[model samples]
Target: MTDSTATRATKPFRFGVVAPLTTDLPTWRDRVRRIAGSGYSTLLMPDVPKWQPAPAPTLAAAAGLADLRVGTWVYASPLRPAWSTAWEAHSLSVLTDGRFEMGIGTGRPGIEDELRELGLPVTRPGERLAQVRETVTRLRELDGPDLHTPVVMAVRGPKARALAAEFADTVTFALMPGDDRAEMTRLVRDFRTDRDVELSQHVAVVGDSVAPFMASPDTDPAALRAADSLAVLPDDPAAAAEEIQRRREEIGFSYFVFGADFAEKLAPVVAELAGH
Candidate 1:
């Protein structure tokens, strides 16, 4: 399908895998090399605590592999001071030769307890937006020559989405609860038409072996197929390609990210669809 005029052809199509931050060094090192060799565009790390490893070092390790870009899927903003993240992200940018993109967010729900345990302040929407803006400012000021880090705003709310559109290098319309493929597609179109920023999407890639474990509660294979084009399926390469190309045409989505477990499963699809 031909892209809408609103979609800029200058934006490139790319693919990424969201790796767990908590993974051991050796496993992560091996997986990152595998991801790069498999033709994925980038190897990403999630900011969630469950991912046990730290994002900065993991991203650095993956950067060591030849020609692989690194980034965060999304980082919880209220968990750390804006200056801290800004400093660390620039450090990452330097370490990775400007291949780092900071994915900042308002933060996940159910994080208050963790914040209190760490004696950190739990910020509201207004404050979090302020932090996003300030953090971006600090990153630009601190970065070395020709080393400006790209910012990926993980839009979780209206204000957050607006912030991303106005300020971020790219805006990701995450697939949240109650979101189906159609809604995601519509949002992608709207964002593309309304903003000049690049677009990204977050979804799971499900192969036959991984589908069961990756399925959401009460979601079956038929349900997933019925829901939307969110999960990239092994059996439906044509459908996957169609959905991917459709989004690319409409929204100029150069970045597609999936969880690490399913990243390998998506290699062939990436091989077929990337950069087209």
Candidate 2:
């Protein structure tokens, strides 16, 4: 299990880096090494289209690096068959020695639209949540690998959050514009019955205000869309980091999913807060 809960319960803070899966594997591994070396505990890579280069190869390649834990910032639940996702996750779990985590959602309109263009179901959140739950169950049944990887549910509404608390090991959210921190906290504190599960938070970059500080396109399409649409900050990486920090405090999100473009530029910000 990921230490997100332990970090939340005992530690003062938790930190992670968002890998730009868009880059080459070697480069992504190098960056993951740096982030892990810098004391960040987790690395998140979101899912995108097959044609779109992403962080999966890099995450698999970096599996042997120290004790770093790897996670998918998110994977579009409605795009592909549930079993395919389960098996893919099982492969990563086996490869990463159970250090892999996955973020899942019914998928946003953009993803649904894209998948529909390809003749797939654009499942609504309710149907998708049920499918996701089944997938998680099936993933747990895999025998060849350790299959100990956890699933972090990404959802926004009350019903979805409740489902996540019951089925997922962790509950996550993309802190888009107008996200309600108070509401989120309330939802988590109330809906969760599993004492073992943890809650994770995510935020995106909006504009030049925090553009340079962002890593790049390592995050999944849903998150990328959220960041592109909501995260508006200064273009200078440093300024963007500062702005991102400000927003983090404002929304009460400890786990941030950033782009690879702002990695070096935002390093200072992460350093100032995490010191790892």
Q: Using TM-score as the measure, which candidate wins?
A: 1
Clash count per candidate: 4, 32
Error of 2 at 170 (Å): 2.1
Alpha carbon lDDT of each predicted model = 0.71, 0.62
Question: Tens digits of per-residue lDDT for model 1 on 64-87?
Answer: 865888888777788778899999
Best by lDDT: 1
Q: What is the RMSD of candidate 1?
A: 3.7
lDDT of candidate 1 vs native? 0.71
Across 1-276, the per-residue lDDT of candidate 2 in tens digits comes to 233322344223456666655567677667878887766767777666664455466567666765788877677777667888888888888888778887777765456678778788767667887778777877878734534678888877767766776777776654444434454445444454534555455544534323322324443434434444333434565765565555444433455555555556656666766621
Report the Cα RMSD per candidate.
Answer: 3.7, 6.1
